[model samples]
Target chain A: MISTKELSRRGFLNMGAAAGAGLVLSQTGLIRPAHAAAPLAPVKAEEALIAFGHTGPTSDEGWTWAHDQGMKAVEAAFPGIKTTYVESIPYSADATRIFRQFVSQGANMVFATSNYGDFLYDVAKRAPKVGFYECDGRNPLDNLGTYYVQHWYPTYVAGIAAGAMSPTGKLGYVASFPVPSVYSGTNAFLMGARTVNPNATLQCISINSWFDPQAATQAGTALLDNGCDVLFGIMDEAGYLQVAQDRGKKAVMWNTDLRRYGPDAYISSIVVNFNDFYVKQVGRRLEGSWTPTYELLPMGGGVDRDAWGATVPAEVAAKADAVRTKMMTEGYSPFVGEIKDAKGNIKVAKGQTMTEQELYHWNWSIEGVSGLDG
Target chain B: MSTWRLQRLPAASPLVSLSARLISVVLALVTAGIILAATGKNPLDLGAQVISSTFGSSFGMADLALLFTPLLYTGLAVAVGLRIGVWNIGAEGQFNLGAFAAAGVALFLPGPPALILPLMAVMGMAAGALWILIPTLARAYADVSELITTLLMNFVAALLVTYVATGPWLDPSGMALATTARLPVEVPAVWDIVHWGLPVGLILAVLLAVAFGFTRWGYEVRIGGSNPGNARYAGMPVRRHLITVMLVSGAIAGLGGMMEVAGTVHRLQGGISNNFGYIGIMVAVLARAAPLGVIFTALLMAVILNGGIILQPQGLTTQTVLAVTGLILFYAAIGDEFARYRLIRNAKPAGTR
Candidate 1:
């Protein structure tokens, strides 16, 4: 299942380049150099239209809900700004069509809350004046920028709390795919846990989707069956947290505060809020100062850990908070080398610290992290 | 007392069928409009917008054409199967394998575009037929229901396509994730965005109409489908005909997939089929499985699908669009049954006579 999901993640990532002549013939233009284009001209707030294409529905109460909250924030900030969104956009030619529809509708700015790859690139290349932002996107064009959260920082903090809370020191992770994001999340988490207990090991089950509550619940059960006391995952729901609550185990979540799902079992979540970011970007677009910018929202800014769950011991919370505060205030990074991969190879030399780029693209598992190697 | 009796006709007239379809669509729309009004949305305004956007601009037309091409292929595929009283529910899987095989040729074969294109087409058709081979065999020999066997292959095909497209065939550029690199060759465009695939599909539909309407093989197949016992008693090779017809049906759907990859998408990716194969079933049924009629039905389906896309920005979810389509199908099916009946007044009381 893990190997198959590793493939599924690939499918999830790249989609739509389907049967159409114009788009294919124009493929050469898709490889445009990443030179910075001039900022778009400003427009009146009331007249300006901003469109968002979300990968999932806003009702998801998780990843997409957070983004919707950000959209709402944009609305509140720029009172007269018109914001429209189409939810659950597939990674297919349909994405290209939706983005094209936005341009045709006179949208001044557009946000695709997922990496749409060529689908977005095709439209961005065609419309040079429209400002576009894709979340977790790699390619940047003159008109297209990309942004994602520095989620690993918060994930590390939650891992610290998990380390102190788990009596057995065995952590289980319900993962979506073996993608870079999952790799970084699992690695940073274990790196934090190992600081508390050197013999700590992490086991992962890739369920092949970013949001499959049933699969996640089963994975959590299997992990518990294997003696994992603390659970962590990069999912868009509280499936595992609910399972942990039922099974009386500790669990860490991602995307918003989900304590209501399982107050006792919930340790903390890698909460992401794009409100300020969206408002600022929209502000920039309205003022004609919007340049395509690559932003990795820092800890405490756009992404952070939620307030500790109710049942979390005060000492454990304080311990994790200290590490969080040090990272935020003193710029301390725990991703320093003396790091070894799962194969026992010294991936990062003892004196060297991994850069943000390296961390963002971490693909391999660290030592003592099993099941993700597939 | 006056009395009337209802009788079902052996066949519904073409005019009756056409009227039934039209009236059903209109009724479905009216029903949807009432629901929308109850929800406080202006259904009339929304309908106008859908019409204007779909017909007003060249872009919308191109979108329709792109959508129409696949339906044409898949529609004809299912229609052909229905002619022989078989249900090729696995057209989705066949379409995927066709695309997969064609993409393999595009990616792996070392040949010029001229030579490779035809090779890809053949490979695609073969793969699609191969995908249905087990189901076809079971139905022909062991009397297993092709509906169940064929339908089950869709999942397997989808998984296999997802596996290869994501694993071994993943684009190395890192620019694209779930798809292979763009194919070096593509089906040339005849219009702005419409490709040669549309023309090819149209031609195939016409050819099938001629063969079925004029040939002895077609007659035998039709007879075999309507009554296997009679055909067998008359010394017709019923099983062989069934096998051939089923394989041909799969090949047609496979060709659609091939065209989609080579002519339209220019890459292989999961969800590439976009439920076109499933939608084809509706198309075939609505057209009464007539090869000539499929062309028109496919267009109608395209209009509805494109309308859904246009209405998306207005906050209509895809699920809602599907519900609306289901309503149309339900009304159409009911209308078909209604068209089959006629009422006649009794001349006199039977006992008195």
Candidate 2:
């Protein structure tokens, strides 16, 4: 028979070895089930819920307002649900700590309202029982999914309003970054403009930022100097429209209603209500029907074509509204047949519409727009 | 002629200054309370909420510890520069370079964890010093302004981070908002918050205080910064000492970047540069460029920031920290002024006196 001391030593060595292996595995994201959260029962909607939004609730304009409203809507939809959120949450190391805190607090579904796919993926893998939904991220973990509104189609409607109101054939489109989202938006705007004004051309430039008011205004000035009489762009605010207001040019806004900021220049905007999506997400989780979905909801699904600015005349607004309704009723695809890239290369061939997958990785801009400054 | 003027005090009384600072802290809290009331919150309840969220729980303490790890290093970095009469506004850029270099080494070199981690640390510090080389020379000999160059380099550093994080070093499997892959080696954690990074930062701060207190290098650096002509006339290598000051300052801040990447996030990201260098400046300024004071200020700032996050659900967002910190810094500035200078009615004209 083995001595008690010897047996205990052997046992201690084995435990140490196992713990070391566990640490290695966890670091590589290969450790499964060893330290994961236990399988948790879905909490009822009546229970208090938690949601985390990156870039706090009231950061003027940007994705912040949209996500903040989503959390508010979640609580409003389910009267018994008490929703809470940490605002101005950065996309950094602090993410996982805060996420774990929420999970530890019995938060059934945590909403990462930013493009923090990697962070969510890591946390969701470790905390397997908790569900995560990130906005605009592309990580497709087992318990993690992402959602982004296809605001391009509504911007197309806004472009139609711009086309109708423009006296000069040139239009300005300011882009935040050269991501696929901007590609989709600028293309749709040009397509809508060409549909209304066949000779319309776009002068588009990306400032490589989302919230630089001075740079945005400078881009607007460059467009105006180059003869663009109708300005529209993607930015945290309607800063570009200030140029339009100053120079008697028609303009459109992105992300929010900003006629108050640019009263004289405002024409229309692509206002996406993320509240609808968040409610659906919460409801789905409650029903246990939630699955990993890299979803890209379209204009009719969540975005609205709010094209009622004084700069856009009554008849033009009516026409834009009619076109919007028709497109929604007929489920019109944003990328129609025979869509041509700048090189006249076929992007969307005849009798085919662009899929969400195709749009998400869009690289080339269409014809009738300025160079992407490559 | 009646005039109110500020007269420089002979010497600062540490005890009186401490009392003044305490009074200023209380005043800041009261002002914060007024702001809270204006926003429709009960000041006492909110105060209770903040304390309970940050200090009441073990996990919250761990989070505070994690935040303190970076803050302490950054604060020391700024304080080191301030002691040498060099105002470094480029700790943020240096921090980015450190993270990039650490991640680079981790990505390219696959050695034993023990060897690789230390190599990453050394490489990180070297990279940070490299980042400051141009700005340091420009400030030291070229008669260029260090403040402008250091601040501008931060933008360049941001661009570099974006390029590296999104292009060559990007994790192949990652999404659009890309980041580098996680380091394979795991650094030991302190209560599961982060690694021994907190202790390392504290040790660095303590060592800095000692070095400044007892070392000849510290004495040389002080004279070189304040009276460069005197330092040169005394045959001291003022330029060399200035380089050391900048290098040490950059290295400390850079170490912070390495700690976050290797221990906390385990990745190189553009978001890593979140004005930590700027916050470090605040810490150094609030602490009057004293290393021990930096430790206290950094820990205090960390509590407010980390605590602010947990309280966001109760309407105390990160902006609450910004507001409270701004108020505290403002009051502390006034308090320090009063400690160093006395306001007196100007004496009658020379003829009359």
Candidate 3:
């Protein structure tokens, strides 16, 4: 039984010896050589290269996973075009530094996949030659593009299902940071729940982090203690679903189709298909018509209801499918007809659909929501 | 002619310090090689790629300079603390506070002429120095370890910056994101300088190195650090010196933060630092707490970090690069220990008959 400190020192010495051996082996040509006999054939010089920056690692099993799948698809589709990426560049000056380096390396197109909009904007301005895309709020410039999924509709639909399934009309919503996107989805979900069960009220809490499982679980437990039978979140992570499973409460997911993330607890999810837009944008860039404008990849963009919606039980899945069909085929607008703001002002009239302009200017929460300090 | 007798020197001159340094470099590379092999990468190619990406172009040079600028100050900060026998692990917090103060000054005060910029820089230094005062005083008076206090302060400083950017300091027109309003154009980089702060940071580090090498204060601090009891017995104000050293360290780190904000970011953002303070410890350690050596170590670190980003697109994982860096640091630490302590062979046992 060697002491831990002595063992650690021994380990360090062994490591040093091993490293020395490895260096000697390499220098003596005992290891395999780096270069092959022949060089790789040159790629077409005119073909555009798209470089994407991801905040999460490719092996994260979540957001970056889906984005990588889409990137792989694009790569397969376009043979001559080059696609490169830097993963897990933290959304800070490091991200900016990486973006600038990419531009300097002659990246014709660059995509920064994070919500640090101002940082993205600054980098975009500095590297005007490189086409930039940000997967966050709108900050469209001459060389920069912003895009977001229309999550409000799917979230509202998922809320309706949660409201219908829950024996108790009490629902819980765990939100992140009270951002407009999160707030919009939460408010819409509550509105949909109210539509089904008029007496139902949602207990909401903001945890101020996007991916902290412990905090999310704590928020979920707090919500359950407040007597909410069903839980949902706009966080798009597995934390809430796991908490729901632990507590045997129903839950809906945000951003991702998260059946795999929480197979036992996830009843359904409001999935965001970022791939459809990402592939399209990559294609557009390859075609040499890259525009700098806000692109909203709504539910009906390219891939429709069948591609995005998912649920646990067969019946719930059917209902989700039906709702998706109605929205896609029957042209059902979720916000159509007689909507009120949180302050009781009528926001939309009967037979009225919100225009793109109205959606862009949407800042008010829906009716029957409380605890908005923003 | 008769008096010109020459003594035979060893084939490798032990007195020539460059040989020892060269051995250390080779050992570092070997350690990196083992790491690369363990991670299933070709060491030769990785080494070539790192070199090419760091020094292949003007862009690489610019990137390297940008990366090194703040690290120079941070390295100096850590070196100062190491010299005074106090481990100041909270330079990151001090740096952040300095940046925050600089941003506040730039955003609020309407610019005069050239003098105002230096004034804001002074304010940044003051903010940084004041930030460390609590830990410094606590360590001096209450015997509380500055290490824990300083490290904990980093979290507080980070949270405070987050609150400021999202609340009162938020840019109104900058939708939903947590960031301060951009500083006015008046605080742009001085005279279109290349890598705006790197030259200044390098000059400061060099000046400090020279001062430390030749000055009486430096000699006293060295003596105090090596033997605190003896230093106090010799009538040196050890406690006061500790406080002074910590304050100076914090001020240097704070100035680095200010330069970053004013020169690069031009606004206060949450992710201003990517663990530069922590990296500062490594730089100082690798440099053996020598100011001039700190500059070179900082430059090497910058090359690795900046080149790591470039290598990422070439099928290299950041984890692999980081693993190599860790290996390098491990070897460097061991090398330093070997350099400092002579490993004596075994002595005869007293009762060996």
Candidate 4:
């Protein structure tokens, strides 16, 4: 209908416009052209496959076990949905391959139970349609989200009980690493303990692992022998708790209620539950309303301190419970300012409350705390 | 009267070794099959899945190559030490130090990648040699057992890596734990996720094979391994050969670690070795310490490792797969023992008759 010269000019203009649009879109972080227009289409429950890559064995009654319970809850919530998991997934190129394998198997959603970082990013970039979730993860792509719990609140509550019960007012904490979680936990615990006993001091030992029972036991022994009457740790198993019981010292633990290992030594645990979170996420994924979200499940929702141990005195439990009730009822956050680092440097100014972001990324050792390096 | 007796041969034929390996692998598979069947799993279906998943796609082959590359270097390292009768069980420590050194250069050095990469390689090799220097000197000078000294260093190296990764080298961006920042330079990927490491490992294996099979140094090392006393009596520098062979052994393993960090992981992290150094010992033993034979043995080990990964979706854990690997190694060891013997028919002595 048109002359050849005119048609060529029109076509050239069209190509230039298209190239410009792509460049602009990519620059603004909208490179996923397919997803930019709409959310992923809903998939049938029977056809949906959810894959999980766990960083540790499910047998460890710790972090991985908590995630495994969430997986089971997803299965129960969506009767027709299929779920599969690979445990002890190492943080290496092997992680990339396993995630890719999940893609090849037509996974509708993939959840890395821990922060896999670039290992998982490599797979998520190529598979835009699949929903991805990473726990304790920092980065989030359009198709990927991150989730973790506000475990510090419960840990602080347990610390109050530890302070009231400790005769020497000295606390020993066995930590995994100098990551944000360890920092926040140690700081929160010491802060709560100082409220009860002004002279209380906490010492932490970093064993450089999330689940090394032998090392944890040795660290606990060293702490107790150093005159610490109460022990606390962020280990998966009841390593330090067993050590405490053997030495007749009180200890608080993480992940699950490991009182069976040392009922006499148990004070409380920062128990974490991911059931409702996983169920809701999977439900959204199925109905096609899924979108990446960075969620920090608050106190008493996905995380809480366990019931008082049989050996815990009523007065100690009452003191800790009063703080727990106030925080839950009035949205009270004990992470107020006037806080100081171990080197006597005032980090948080007086009357200034710390935000969720600051609490989540806490990295320095607080005043009256020692033995953490970053 | 005639009697049949078993006689041990001084050396095993290549054909016998090959057959023994085949028979042992088959026996191991059959044993694994029985165990799977007992556990209510369909072995035949699982086997089909393993084959199809491993060889059916380009990605699978690339994955196999990535796994194969590290084993090749470590296998060659152990085999080289075997030539001089030095048990360099400390290959794991050398590998860690090599990775650490390479990562150090990548992190601190500001030069372009082109110059830095080769420098990283040299630094890696030097670090690996240095890591084993104490054990090597102890063995060559004081007659201390390299086996015990080398093995103990592995724990120290592991602890050191963990400490540095969690402390000084921890990612400043707060995006990762127990690891350094992602390296700026990578061993350029050749296909899919597989990088230049595959070819590098292959070339090293061929070069080592040539050097060990055709060089006078290799012949003297072999003679020294066979009998240090005899070599010394014949005016051979047995101590010099021992020192050089052990150092070269550590260097090869160090190169492996360097390639692993720069090529595959692209970061310095704890537990990066993934037991590759230990598994290389099995590969060397299966290859009868032959440099050229190591290629086939490493590939075989890679296949088994990949097979374990492919079967993960079938409700199999890494521990179960490790057990299967142990079974294969056990059978292969028994086969090696059998390879040294032959059945012979002989007549009774005249006095007995």
Candidate that scores best on DockQ: 4
RMSD of 1: 6.7
TM-score of 1: 0.91
lDDT of 2 by residue, B118-214 (tens): 9888988888888888878987788687788878888888778866775577664324455676678756787765588888898898899888888
lDDT of 4: 0.84
Q: Which residue pairs show backbone clashes in model 1?
A: A14-B178, A17-B265, A18-B264, A18-B265, A19-B264, A19-B265, A20-B264
* Candidate 4 TM-score on chain B: 0.97
Task: Give the alpha carbon lDDT tens digit for every residue of A1-106 in model 4.
Answer: 2232343233333323322221111111111222232467798889899999998788999888999999999999898899989988987777877887788778
Give the CAPRI class of candidate 4: acceptable
lDDT of 4 at B222: 93
What's the i-RMS of each model? 4.6, 8.9, 12.0, 8.2
> What are the per-residue Cα lDDT tens digits for candidate 2 across A1-374?
32323432333333233222211111111111111222245567887476665644456575678777787888888889877677656667667667766765667788887666555676777766677877776555667767777776787888788888777779888876555677777788888888789898888877756667889999999999999999888786767888888888878887778888778888887887788878887887776666555566767676777759875678888877777887678766657567777777665556655544445545457887774524
Q: Please state the CAPRI-style docking class of candidate 3.
A: incorrect
Cα lDDT, model 1, residue A61: 84
DockQ of each: 0.31, 0.35, 0.17, 0.43
- In Å, residue A209's CA in model 2 sits off its true spot by 4.6
* Stretches of candidate 3 exceeding 4 Å from the true structure: A1-46, A126-129, A165-178, A197-209, A212-228, A302-374, B1-22, B37-40, B113-116, B185-187, B190-195, B343-353
DockQ of structure 2: 0.35
Task: Answer with 1 or 4, whichever has the higher TM-score.
Answer: 4
lDDT of 3 by residue, A199-256 (tens): 7777778775666668888999888888888887755357777777787777877645
